[model samples]
Target: MEIGLNHYLVLSTLLFAIGLIGVMRRKNLLLLFFATEILLNSVNIAFAAISHYYGDLTGQLFVFFVIAIAASEVAVGLGLLIVWHKRHGNIDLDHMSTMRG
Candidate 1:
């Protein structure tokens, strides 16, 4: 079967759902960060599709910026996660309640 706009949309929707579920259910900081990235990427997919449909490049340009933002977010998130793990001796988010002032 040939792929079309609907197929792209369906894929984006499915990815969004998975990411939402992951964000809601996962406790690990790493997984939480990953889920956030997935959500951002799904938006990129939809924007690219809409741009293609309208013969406009603006949406695609926006997606590229989103991707750049997501990459920076992942870097910061992982760095924070590592610091949290080192301080707490574990990665369980529930145990990380205190932040020094």
Candidate 2:
């Protein structure tokens, strides 16, 4: 079977939708972070497909930058998660409220 741009787009759409649902429904910050990663991966798939179709390197270059950013985001986000866990002893996002302050 020959995969085309449309196929790639459809797959990415499904992935994004699943990620959105997870992000909206999950109470755990770790799960929410995983969903965000899925969303980023979907974007990368679309960009790579477009770059391949256009025979241009720009999209691939953008993908590389995106990967770098995602790596940094995950690292920083995990660090924050650790700190929050240390203070709160939990990672449930719903358990947080500034009114507690």
Find the candidate with the highest TM-score and give its number: 2
lDDT of 2 by residue, 21-100 (tens): 99999999999999999999999999999999889999899999999999999999999999989988999987885658
Clashing pairs in 2: none
Q: What lDDT is obtained when candidate 2 is compared to the true structure?
A: 0.92
Put down candidate 1 lDDT per residue, 1-101, tens digits, no spaces.
Answer: 87778878999999999999999999887888889989998988999998998899999999989989888887888898788777777786677766651
Candidate 2 ranges with C-alpha deviation above 4 Å: 99-101
**CA shift of 14, model 2, Å:** 0.8
The per-residue C-alpha lDDT of model 2 at residue 77 equals 97
Error of 1 at 11 (Å): 1.7
Single out the weakest 10-residue window by summed lDDT for candidate 2.
Answer: 92-101
How displaced is residue 60 in candidate 2, in Å? 0.7
